[model samples]
Target: MTNRHQKYEVLDGLRGIAAISVMVMHFLQDLSVPVLQSAYLSVDIFFILSGFILTHSYGDKLHHALGIGQYLKMRLVRLYPMICIGLVIGAISLCAMKLDGAAAFSVGNFVSAVGENFLLLPYLGDMSVGSFIRTSAHGVPTLGNAGNFPLNPPEWSLFFEMFASLLFVAAIRFDRRSLLKAAYASLALFVVYGMMIGINEGKLTIIVNQGWRADNFVGGFFRVTYGFLIGVAIRKMLDSDGAPHAYWMSGRLIRSARALFVAFLLITLFPTSIKGLYPLAILVFVAPMLIFQGAKLRPGGALSARACSFVGWLSYPLYCVHYPVGRLVFTYLPNSEQHIVGAAALACGLSIAAAAVLAKCVEEPVRRYLMKRFAGAASRSAAPPVRAA
Candidate 1:
């Protein structure tokens, strides 16, 4: 592929790795394993990647050719199919829980949860009553505190993602200098916000988990904005005349860099402690470095390229659906300390399988159909009428 059209296969692979790390982290959290405590930071990695990739893919188009409505439609088409699948799976799991006496069923709350989640909105109702009963009675798994998107907690990121996409489009209209200034301003605001919260709570760490609840939702906006803008800045740099060529590094060095990138990501995610400003540093500095490096490093061979593409294709589906699917697994399986590890492993395996099936059998087909249908309608509407002779 030409440079303009080339896919950053290494970045794709890294994204898949991040998604799996998050899945494992969630399972372990439910099972009471203290490992990978900071894996929730994977959402930051996602924000950066989304900014970088969308800028690369749609920056020029958004500025020159694509309309705001069409751009949003494209995003919805790409994202909503998997979201629907996740919502359906979550609803089914909730029903099963109620039927099996694992959870209390409230028709009003249940219907509200399904309706809100179906629209990609967080369920704001008081789930504190029936929701925690499962956790209390049977030791069934929960993501703690009925987060913003309680049905599928990880979807909190997706909500921020959509919001950030709109922000990105709006910001891209500015000149490069103005864009950079905006990004810097966002960074400043984020640091100030983090410090204020940390100091008020008498903690030294930058808060990474935000936007999952009503109180700290603003933090989520700052978190995603800063990360996304960093990504956009990296893309802008790479697109400039002085930027390094993709082939500047030798293939062997690129491969080594890829390995090191993965190692750094794992080290950052599997932190033993959440103290200090390291998490903030990683979000502000390390994530952009990874994106810049990944953009420059292509996959090594045909087999490697195929693997990267496959994993990248699988990442979104895996991320969207993993929580509900794994929750169901943990609900049914024994989650005792001895068997918890086994259960977590099984949950991960089953989640991957379900994600793959959904991607291949459902998400892909629906997206293609929607794109074709919408594109044809758009073209027809844009075409002018001919006069008869």
Candidate 2:
């Protein structure tokens, strides 16, 4: 294994760790345990990581030449397949809920809900079917808030993620010097916006918990901009001459790298039992440190390389599918603590398995098809003009 390929495996491992944390965190909702109290921070972590990976992968290539169409087509192929699958499964799960005695399970409502999910729109909106349900199974309304997907709640972040990716096309226009300056400017905007919201609303705006809210507009923007640009700044450093070697050490760095991710998993799975805006604290302080730490990871053994590669591949698929699968299990299967725990465990397993399936069956094939088209288009664009006699 080459050091080049290992560049972002640790980061990928963190993403996988976050995805599983979110899965368990949702399941633990039924049990009313606050384990993985800061697991919600995973969303912000993802926003930061997305910016890092996007810039790392495309910054140089796209900066020199703008290929917005192909760039976006690539993104769609990468992101939209699981979205489509989640929408379909969420629809089925919603219909299954109707059959299981939920009063809100009208076919008209089901169609509306599934349609919204397909658009990657927030399912917590006015037409949100999940919000109205009073199923006999849970007794309480199964939906938590209007901002989250009742059918597939975790996807709200992707709505923001997509928008952030689009913004990167604009970010590429600037050189590294200007990009960091822009990042700091956006960070200030984030701080100002967050403070205004917090002071006026008497609520913290930076932490992303509870699916969606109207007030989240400013806060969500800041959360993403700050995270995305900060990631770009980090990528700028990584892109600089002599960056990695300046920071690199030996195998102990590898263990430290692995331990950072282990800590993330442990924080997500276990009760920190710490109170007072710990999730916010993690977002404001700890998460960026993790990204920086992951950046410093050099290549280790073959096993380490392989593990990180798998982690990188699996992270996005796991994230995209977990919520719908978990929702299906919880809505249809059972509600008892023991049952929910088992269901949660089942969700974790099925998510891992389903992610592998999605990767092989959907992601890879679509990406190949899109890349082929993109190549053809680029070739045509690059072909020289012929002067005919």
Candidate 3:
């Protein structure tokens, strides 16, 4: 691989790592263990990284050209196949819960949850049908019930991601100059909105609270835009060809400084607290782009490259399936100490394998088919203009 490709590999590895953090968080939760209580914050890591990827992939299109229709089509093809799988899994899980005697399995709740999942909305706003029941052969409404892993817990993030992608597309379709300007403007507004709600209610406004509370508005908005903007800003850096100094000393120094800053922020700040220090976090979020230059990767020959790339390749599907599988295993375990650890490991491993299979067998083929079709159409359309010119 060229240096550019190797650098992308580094980012890919980081993406896998972020997904793993979330997987571990869910595993801990399911086993009733305490580790990385803030593991949920890994979503923010994903956000920043995704922002960078988007900008890298499509920033130039937004700047010098436009292709809203084709861009959205590609996004849909890339995102939807797995989502459809998740929805199917969720539906089957709900049926299994009905058999388990989970009382929340009422026809109404079942219909509502399935309906929401189908619509790509939050199931029951914040609760999922599977989560509401927790895999008991029998379902009952009680305080002991912690509803997670309903069908596809990881999908909630994807919904936000898809929405963010649309925002990016809209920037191009509308011929908006400086997408960064647009993203920053939205970020400022969201932070202020979050603060206003936080102050008024004396609590943070976290969107997607299962019942669609107004307080959750800021939370949801922040989750979508913050990471999306981070990605956008990174694209800006790459566009200038690792700007502010060109090659060697300038690029190296910029990359190093960004890495240091990102590390400091990750160690020092918490996602929940981002509401209070929103402005500062925005500045801090740009570090990843600086560090992820095409030339900075130090690939350790062959073995390391394969290992990192493998994880990167599997990360998305692994992320999608791990949480629900964790929940499923937890429900079956007999609540013994030894059992929990063993169960967590088994669940994680099985989920990762299952996700990999799905990715390879299902997601990749579908994505390829769609990409070829879309790219063909795009090429055909452009040919007419060229010939006319």
Candidate 4:
């Protein structure tokens, strides 16, 4: 029997893959290459994984040993360090652009953007109106049309992830039946929101491009809610006494499962004209299936296990830092269509290196310090008061 607290290495590897896909998608887009068209869907994978992993790790603790304040503190320690690193990178990138005269940069607007984004709040400016006082002034339009978190577009997802965490904590008191009801309610809301978006966009398929702007901000909520809760439900299933047996745990079958999982993600994320229910289907079915399978799959060997663990360790830092790093490289480097392919390739390598540095050198140390400090504070606060004799 597997240890309940052991890390799901396969899920971690899949998460790293998803993070890479997102980084590549953004890099290609910046270079005007139209590949990985559906890679934004990788964010859905992240939401699912977040739900699954968080539930697996904290489902019982939150109900017993962990208090709400302490849980939030742990989460903040895990997430906020990288966010600060990303914001600093973004600020530096903007300053570089201003120095290079590539775009206009306004200190006031940038300061405002930084302040809001640092708080993980969305930028409420008119992103389309690229003028001196708006998004353009902060160099956000050049990056990606000024999303909600103009400083770091991917940060919008992080915002939703944190929101989902809070929601998950709030529902900790729910019984199994109540949890299922909550999941179904969230699913219904997601479907309704998708249908509305599809109708308005004049597309038969559910639009996946959301949660980044003022107009489609609400869509982000439904997207994350559905995916995250589904993940939670799947975790509950896996934890139950009647959970399905993994008959496919043999070496050959394990390899096949790993291969198929990678192939399926590639196929789903590649450019395709197949629309309509495709995106919604992936979220509703594909993502959860992968998580369920990932939870059951073991690495075929020690080397493979180590590799997966490394990538999983790198995933969050990579995702958080890649956009700004790539943007910096693309902005300063040669980026003609012919040359840009090479430039993007180089940027990818550099992004990996940067992620490693940030993760090991910066994020880890900061998080350790913060967690240690928080733990000390919590222990002291919980200590008994001295009695005067």
Error of 2 at 254 (Å): 8.7
Worst 10 residues of 4 by lDDT: 380-389
* lDDT for each candidate structure: 0.69, 0.62, 0.54, 0.69
Predicted candidate 1 versus true structure: per-residue lDDT over 1-389, tens digit per residue: 12445567777887887888888777776444466777777788888888777776677677456677877777777778888888888777766666555555378988887788778787766553223223323544332355667677788888888888788878666655565677678777777776677777888765557777655677888888887777776777777633234323323343553574556566545665456366766775566666777777767788888877777777899998998887677566653335667877887899999999988998889987986776434422221201000
Per-model TM-score on C-alpha atoms: 0.85, 0.80, 0.73, 0.85
Score residue 101 of candidate 1 by CA lDDT: 58
lDDT of 4 at 172: 55
For candidate 4, write residues 1-389 as lDDT tens digits. Answer: 33446677777778787788888777676333476777788888888777777776667677567677787777787788899898899778666655654445477767788899999888776432221112122334333256777666788899998898898886656554566667668767777776778788887865566787877889888778777777776677665633334322322343544674565567545666355366666666556667777777777788887877788888898888887776677566643334656767887899899999988888889877997888445422322211000
Clashes of each: 0, 4, 16, 0
Please identify model 4 stretches exceeding 4 Å from their true place. 30-33, 98-106, 127-144, 175-177, 202-204, 241-257, 335-337, 376-389
At residue 117, give the lDDT of candidate 3: 62
Candidate 4: clashing pairs of residues? none
Error of 2 at 238 (Å): 1.9
- Error at 129, model 4, angstroms: 11
Model 3 lDDT per residue over 1-389, tens place:
11222145555555566577667656655444355444455565566666656555555554344377776676677777777776676566546545554424456766676676667676533342433224444334232322322356567777777788877765433222355566667666656665666667676652212212323433566556755665555545554543333323434444442353344345323434444553344234433433445225544566766765777787777776676566556555554234555766777787888888988998779877876887445522221110000
TM-score of 2: 0.80
RMSD of 4: 6.7
Question: Model 4 Cα displacement at 287 (Å)?
Answer: 0.9
Tell me model 1's lDDT, rounded to 2 decimals: 0.69
